[model samples]
Target chain A: MKTVLIFEPLDFSAKVIATLTEHGFEVSLNKDNISIREALEKYSLIYMRLGVKIDAKLLDECNSIKCRFILIPATGIDHVDEQACYKHQIQIISFKNKKELLKDIRATAELTMALTLTLLRNIIPAIESTKSGIWNRDLFRGRDIFGKKVGIIGYGRLGSIVSNYFHTFGAIVQVYEKNAVELPSHFERASSINDIFLNNEIITLHVDYQESNIQLINSSNLMLATKQPVFINTSRGQLVNEADLLVALENKVIGGAAIDVVNEELGFNPKNPLVAYANHHSNLIITPHIGGCTIDSSHKTEEIITNELLDLIKNEV
Target chain B: MKTVLIFEPLDFSAKVIATLTEHGFEVSLNKDNISIREALEKYSLIYMRLGVKIDAKLLDECNSIKCRFILIPATGIDHVDEQACYKHQIQIISFKNKKELLKDIRATAELTMALTLTLLRNIIPAIESTKSGIWNRDLFRGRDIFGKKVGIIGYGRLGSIVSNYFHTFGAIVQVYEKNAVELPSHFERASSINDIFLNNEIITLHVDYQESNIQLINSSNLMLATKQPVFINTSRGQLVNEADLLVALENKVIGGAAIDVVNEELGFNPKNPLVAYANHHSNLIITPHIGGCTIDSSHKTEEIITNELLDLIKNEV
Candidate 1:
C-alpha cells in the first residue's frame, strides 16, 4: 500500500478518511508542525488544505523525494506553486479542476446575499444594541432591498446565482461581465463597469482573480458610484484595493461594505486597513473568507475529491 | 378646518404632513409631553402612533371634549381602546382597513428572512469575532438554507412572502395555517402545528397577536422541535413566551433563535430573560422590533394613510 500523508484539521469528513483507508492507502495523519521536506521524503502522496501554502521553495524541496502527487481539498489553487510543480514533474490535484465537485457553489452566493442583507438592514447594530439591553428599534430603521438597483460584477455560476436571489427579492439586477451570455429575463446587462457603479444602489463583486485584475476596484473606479451603494465582495480579496475601500468608507462615498475576503487574509494582521476600518465602523462587516465554507459544500467537496483521488491511484497502478 | 393634533416623531413623511395641511386641516405638531386630556379638549382629531396606548381613560376624557376621531398611522390597532371609542362616539381610523396602504408588507417579510439567514449562518458571532481582529474562517462554518426543511407558522401575507423567499433559496417550505387557503404549488401544508415542529430544520412565526394566541410558542410546543431548528420571529412579541425561548436556548433544544420582537418590548427591561440570555449566548440574536420599519415601507404607508385620511375628510364635508 502507498503511504499517504494527511494534514491535520483539513475539514475532511470521517467518511472521506474511511474511503481512503478502504482503498488500501496507509493514511498517516500528521499533527506535528514539521517541514514539507520531511513529508515529501517519507510519502509519495500528500493531502493538504488551501491554508497550507505550497510555494516555489517548498516545491523545490520535493526534487529528491518519493512525493509525486499533491492534493488540495479546495477549489482555489492560488496558494499552490503550479509552475514549480510542473518543473518538479509533480502532479497537482484540486477541486478547482473537477467541475463536478463545484456543483454546490450556491453556498458562496448565499453568503454574499446574507452579508448584503446584513449591511442593508443594519442588523449588526440592531443585534448589538439588543444584547446591551436596549430596545431602540427606531435607531435601526433600514432601507428595503425591494425595488433597489443591484449591480453584479460577474455573471458566472456564482454571480448568476446571486443575481437571481436579489431579483427574486424584487431587486433590479444589472450585470457587468466581460463575456456576453444569455441572462435571465429580469437581469439587465450593464454597458460598462461605470454604468454598474453609476446606476446601482448595491454593488457586489464576484469576478475571478487574475494578475491583470489586481486592484480592479481602486479609488478612481469607486469614485464613479453615484448612488450611495452598499459594496460587497465575497470573491478574491486581491481584486479590491483595501486602502481605497477604507477611504471610501471614511468619506461616506459608499453607504456600507460587507467583505468576506480581505487582501491580508492568509495571516491575521491587526494593522490591515480593512480590518482596522471594520473594527471602528459598524457599517463595515468583515468575515474571514468563509463564503464557501458551509457544511454541505465542504462535505460534497470532500466526497468528490476522495473519489477522484481513488480513481487517480487506480490509473497510476 | 378641523384641528388635527400630530404626534411627535411617528415616522410620518413630510409629504403626509403636507397632504393634511393642503386639505384644510390645521395641523398642530406637538412636542411637549402633555396629557391625553389636553389633546382631547384642544383638538377635534388626535393622531397617534403604535407606541402610545389609548386606553379607556383617554377615551372617557374625549367624551366630554371636541375630539371626534382617533387616527392611528399603522396597521395594528391593538393599543387603541375600541369599546371606549364606540361609547364616546370617537371614530377609530387606522391603516389596517386600507388594503392599498398595506402593499409594502414586504419590509416585515424581508426582515424575517434576514433574521433567519443570520441565525443559520452564525453571522452575529462571525461579525463580532471579525471586529475583534480575528480571521478564523473555520469557526464560522455555517449550514446552507438550501435543501433544508423550513416550517412557516402562518400563511398570511407576510408568511406567504417569506415562504416564497425560502422556497426560492431551495428550501422545502411547510406551512401551518389554521385557515386552508389556496397556497402556491411549491408549498406543502402541514396538517397541524406539531408537524411543523416535528419535521423541520428551520421554523419562523408570523401569526397575529390575539387573546387565544398568547404564548403560542410555549415550552411544550418548543420541546417538540426534533430537528433542533433555528427559530425566528419578526411578528408580535406577545406571541412568544420569552422564558420558554430562553429555556430552549440554554438547553440547546433548538439550534438557535433570532428574535426581532419580545413580549416586554414596550419598554427596555434589562431584566428580560431573552435579552440577558442573548448577552451571554452567541447563538441567540435579538433585534428590537424593526420588522416593518424600513424607510420605503414607512413612506409608502404614510402616503397611503394620508390619501385615506383626505378621502375621509372629504366624505365628512
Candidate 2:
C-alpha cells in the first residue's frame, strides 16, 4: 500500500483517512514538528495547507525519496517552491486546477458584504456600546444602503458577486474593471477610475494584488471623490496606501473604512498608525485577514482536494 | 397666517422646512422643554414626535384652544390620547394614512440584515479582538449565509422585505405569518410555527407586539428549535420573555441572538440578565432601538409628513 501523509488537522465531513485506507493507501497524520527526512522516507503522497512553507530544503529532501505528488488544499501555491517541485518531477495538485470545484466561492463576497453592512450601519460601535452598558441609540444613527451609489473597483468573480449583493439590496452598482468584459444589464460601467470615485457614495476594492495596483487609492484618487464615500478593502492591503487611508479617514475626506487585509499582514505591529487609528475611531473597522476563511468554504475546498487525490491514486494504480 | 409649532429640532434637508414655510403658515420651532399649554394657546397646528406624549390633560388644554390638527411625523399614534383628540374634534394625521409616502421603508430591514451578518461572522468579537491588539483569525472562522435555511416569523412589510434579502443571498426562506396571505412564489410557507423552529438554521422575528404574542419564544417554543438557530428580534422585545431568552442562550438552545428592542427599554438597567450576558458572551449582540432610525429613513419620513401636513392645510383652507 502507498503511504499518504497529512501535515495538519482538517475539519471536513468526509473521513479522509478512512477513504484513503479503503483505496489501499496507508495514511499517517503528522504534526508540524515532524522531521522532513522521516516524512519523505515513509510517505510517497503528501497533503498540507498553504501556510506550510515548502521551501527548497524541504523540496530537496522530498526529491531524494519516493515522493511523487504534493496535494495542496488551497487556491494559492505561493508558499511552495514551484521550480524545485518541477525539477523533482513531483506533480502539484491544487483547488485552482479544478474549475468546477470553486463554483460557489461566495464566502469572500459574503464577508465583503458583511464588512460593508457593518460600516454602513455602525454595527461594531453599536454592539460595543450596547455591551458596555450604554444604550445610546442617538449616537449610532446610521445610513441606509438602499438608493446609495456603490462603486465596485474590480469586476472579477468576487467583485461581480459583491456587486450582485449590493444591487439586490437596492443600491445602484457601478463597476470599473481594466480587463473589460460584458457586464450584467443592471450594473453601470464607470468610464474611468475617477468616474467611480466621483459618482459613487460607497467604494469597495476587489482587485488582484499586483505591483502597479499598489497604492491605487492614494491621495490623488481619494481627492477626486465628490461624495465622502465609505471605503472597503477586502482584496489586498497593498492595494491602498495605509497612510493615505488613515489621513483620509481623519480628515473626513472619506466617510469610513473597513480593512480586512493589510500590507505586511504577518508582521502587523500594534504600533502601526492605521492600527492605532482603527483602535480609537469607530468609523474604521479592522478585521484580521479572514475573508475566505469560512467553515463552509474550507470544507468545500477540502472535499474537492480529497476527491481529486482519490482519483489521482486510482488512476496511478 | 395660521401658526404652526414645530416641537423638536429636525435635521432634515432645507427643502422640508422651506416647503412648509412657503405654504403661508407661520412656523415656530421649540425645544422639548416647551410647555404644552403655552404652545396650544399660541398655535393652531402642532408638529411633534411620538416621544412627546400628548396625555388627557394636554388634550384638554388643546381642546380649550384653537389647535385644529395634531400632526405626528411617525407611523404610531399610541402616544396621543385618541379619545381626547376625537372629543376635541381635532384631526390626527400620521404617515400611515399616506400610503404613497412610505413606499420604501428600508431602514429596519437593512438593520436586520446587518445584525444577521454580524452574528454569523462573529464580527463583534473579531473587531474587539483586533482593537484589543489580538490578531486572532482562527478564532473568528464564520459560516456563510448562502444556502442556509432561514425562518421569518412574520410575513408583513418588514418580514417580507427581510425574507427577500435572505433569499437574494441564496438562503431558502420559510415564512410563518398568522394572517396567512398568499406568499410570493419563492418563499415556502411553513405549516406551523413549530415547523419553522424545527427546520431552519436562522430565525428572525418581525411580528407585531400584542397581548397574546407576549413570550412567543418561551422555553417550549425554544426547545422546538432542533437546528439551534440564531434568533433575531428587531421588533418589540416584549414578544420574547427576557429570562427565557437568556436561559436559551446559556444552554445553547439557540446558537445566538441579536436583539434591538428589549422590554422596559426606557428603563433599561445594566444589571438585566440579558444585558449582563451580552457583555460576557460574544454570541449575543445587543443594539439600542435604532432599527428604523437611519438618516435616510428619518429624512424620508420627515419629507412625507411635511408634504402631508401641507396638503391637509390646503384642504382645510
- Listed in order, each prediction's TM-score against the native is 0.94, 0.91
Candidate 2 off by > 4 Å? A1-18, A25-70, A88-90, A97-100, B28-46, B50-52, B57-68, B76-81, B88-90, B97-100
Q: What value does the lDDT take at residue A58 in candidate 2?
A: 80
lDDT per residue for candidate 2 within A1-317, as digits (tens), equals 78888765545334666777887888777756476555655678887763456667886655366777788866646567778777877778886545457768677788888888899888887877877878767778889889999999999777888898898789999999999588999999998788988999999998876568988988888877778999998887888888888888888888899988777665567777887888788889988877877888777776678788778767877
Report the C-alpha lDDT of model 1 over A1-317, residue by residue, as the tens digit: 77888764455577877888887778877878556778777887887765657777876656487777888767667988788877877788886645555755568888988998898889999988888888887788898889899999988778888888888888889999988688877789998877898899999998877787889998887878889899999988899998888888888888899988888777768678777778788889988888878877777776777778778768977
Model 1 residue runs over 4 Å out of place are A5-11, A28-41, A62-64, A97-101, A314-317, B8-11, B28-41, B61-66, B97-101
Angstrom error at residue B174, model 2: 0.6
- True-structure lDDT of candidate 2: 0.80
DockQ of each: 0.70, 0.66
lDDT of 2 at B138: 67
lDDT string for model 2 (B57-175, tens) is: 87665536777787776654556776887787767888654544665868888889888889988888888778877666768888888889999998877888899889888899999
In the order shown, the candidates' Cα RMSDs to the true structure are 2.3, 3.0
**Any idea what lDDT model 1 has?**
0.81
- Model 2 docking category: medium
Model 1 residue A20 lDDT score: 80
